[model samples]
Target chain A: MNALLTSAVAGLTAAGAYALLGVCAVFTFRLVAVVNFTGAAIGTAGTFSMIGFISLGVPLWPAVVLGILVGTLAGALIGLVMTQWFSEATATTKAAVTAALLVGIVALGLRLTGGQSPKEFPTLFPGSAFRLAGVEVTVASVLTVVLALVFTLLADAFLNRTRTGLHLRALSERPMAAELLGVRVRILALLVWAVTGAFTTFALMIIAPQRSPDFMSLSLLVVPALAAALVGAFRSFPLALAGGLTIGIVEGMSSAIDGISQYRGILPFFVILAVLLWSQRGARWDEAR
Target chain B: MTRTLDVSGLVINRAGLPVVRGVSLSAQKGQISVLLGANGAGKTTLLEGLSGIIPTSGGDIALNGRSVIAARAGERARAGLSHVEQGRTVFRQLSTEENLLVGMAPGADLADAYDLFPELLNRRGVRAGLLSGGEQQMLVIARSLLTRPEVILIDEMSAGLAPVVVQRLMAAVRRLADAGLAILLVEQFAALALRIADHAYVMRRGELVYDGLPQPLLADPDRLHHLYLGDVQAA
Candidate 1:
């Protein structure tokens, strides 16, 4: 029973990071109508930059800030390309553009990192564990869960209770109608991109220390994040966060079963396939949007 | 009569082929100027070009005596030019009150909209997509009114609606015109549009074939039939 409780606490810590990534994906998808595939790669790049700055004898905190700024600029750059070059493109075309950007960013990150080997990631949290109900929990784990909940509440308030949030909700529903109604869509899209980029960096910063940090593994974390966002239909932030937590807990629990221990990595794919099949049943192919 | 919306020699080209050729028209405040035509007659295209949704090859569009040819769609909207597009495309995911808030200009009040469309007041919290077709139409028009526009260009306001609902919508539109808003209405129902129109224009194959008072076009059925069905004998 203690073992099971330990695994659950560990899973919750990981779930907080996954929830952050899922929230970013859902937010960008809602505002811009594109599933941004480059988020993890951008986060990976930001992490490498922070490490590089540390290697150069820069202070740890400032280096992290600089790295987040780089990620934010990368996101803004993607927004600039989307709004300036492909503003008139269809939803499929815009999504394809994001896919292409994902490939480009991954390649750039691998080149900059010099190799795909795992590197030791430094943690900002103090190494301390406390006993709770006969289960040991790390300070970082508590911090992660608390920060995730706070961010979620703040995001919900910003989206529902503010004027800009109302405009964003309107744009997500019908972009052309929103434009005709005098909403500055392009500017708002750029802001969403910047926010998503910064959030991605923050998620990676908290989560990367738990595993071996590498370009390939860190960037591929988007797959599970994407599955979580898909569970929300890329609309509801709270649902996406809950989906991410559920996925993390399920994955953690499945590892205890001997029969399914080897297939842990394939769980997210099954969730995605199940969701797609269920949502598309009896739905028209041409009814995308 | 002071002109609220004035257009002269407006030309629109789609893929190098002219869709609206040298169209000229003027709308006065407190009146409805109806554009009557069949499908593919370029009525919708002309309105799109005027509202800056599509590029115009050559034209001058003046709103309240100020030229707005260089403005984009949002800029035109800010300049008091409101467009209620075809099919009444409301933000389906937003509530009726939220939709009205989106269209409201700075410092504008929602009480005016609620006063104008009382039915919408009762369903303000409901999602716009869940509303009935007639209610959706009323919501879109009510949202546009929140902008306090000087001129409104509405396309196919009565599409796929019951006759009684259409009558109610038309009565609301007449009230708007009576309240001194210039209205440019495009419709396929010639008889229905002529009843409320002070001036009317008929288009055939992207060109204005007739421009005069609605009484003459309503009196001569053969001319109206030829303009729409391309057969004078069908009248």
Candidate 2:
């Protein structure tokens, strides 16, 4: 029992990462109207680039920054494509484009990154732990939690308070009307993609060290993130963040058990299914919510 | 020099068919130019083309004696063209003041809108979607007005509103014309729109069927009815 509790507590780092990624997913959905399945893959482009740079004898911090830039650029490129060709597309169409792009990105990422090969993932906060409720807690876990909370608060304030932020919100709600009112629609959309890209890469950077997982597995982390987003209906940021943490805790507890430990990665799929079924409980096929 | 908003030989296509063809018109400063048309006469498409909401296949739209046909919707708006789009396209999630601020250029005052519609003063913090139909109309018009536009293209200002509300809105539009702002208004209430309009243009089958003083159209309802009835018979 204590081992399960310890494993759940240790899962806080993954929880923080999942929460941050979920927050980014929700942000893009609300602001840019894309479900963005390519989020983790875009970050993996940076993550792999950072790994490559580190292997090439580059210093740690510079390589990480370069990796983040790569991710940001990839995100901006996707935004540009969406705005240029599919600006008026329905939400379903936009989501379809993202899902297609996700497959493309992952295939390209696997080829570019060393497929089926292991890489060393050095911990950012190695050997850093503190006693919390008789269990030693890592600083990385605390930092992830704090980062998710602070970033969410900051984003909420930005979207609600600032002038440009107001324009962004207006653009998301009414694109045609907003453009007629002189709001720069494309620029704000690119900004959203770039910012979320930076956040996703940063989140992956903190948690990647704990498990030196392969590129394909790392890129697929967008699933859990999306599951978290589904919990919030992709609208409520706080709810998505909480859903991410809970998912992580559940996965961790399951990992400690004998029967379900191997199938822990499939847990997010179940959460998404449950959320979809619950949301559609009382509605008919045509009027399904 | 008073800058006028004018379009010449404009053609617009929708779904492979020309909805508006060879249309020429102009809105002079300090005068209301009302475009009257029946339900499928392409009045909305003409207004949308002039505002650059949709693409214009052919034509030249000029503002301040310069061609703005190449400018997109955002560019045209920044170049002093404000469009109060159909169905009260106010940002529903935004507060009244925020919607007003969207059109507001930097360092400009917001009192111009409130002075025009003082009812918006108390509803400043309320979300625009929560407002009544009349209030939403006021908010959309106020939003367009805050841009300090030299010319405003209003689409169906009397759509789905009470007669009292329509009267109030027309009065405000008249006040706007009096302030030397070039006005192009599209309204379903032909009698009310003609009451204040200096010039009136009626559309039929994607072409301008009548272009003259509003007095003539108001005096002869049979002619206007015949023009409106032409399409109904054809269809």
The candidate maximizing lDDT is 2
Residue lDDT tens for model 1, B1-235: 9899999999999999999998989888999999988899899999999888888999799999999999988889889888899998988988899999986898778998888789999899999999999999999998989888888899999999999998888888888999999999998778888889988988766778777899888888778978776654311
DockQ of each: 0.60, 0.77
DockQ of 2: 0.77
Clashes of each: 0, 0
Badly placed stretches (over 4 Å) of model 2 are: A282-289, B1-3, B231-235
Docking class of 2: medium
The alpha-carbon deviation from the true structure for residue B30 of candidate 1, after best TM-score superposition, in angstroms, is: 2.8
Encode model 1's per-residue lDDT on A39-93: one tens digit a residue.
Answer: 7777777887888888999899998998899888888989999987887788889
* lDDT tens digits, residue span A211-247, model 2: 5566777788999999999998999989998999999
Residue A109 of model 1: what lDDT?
78
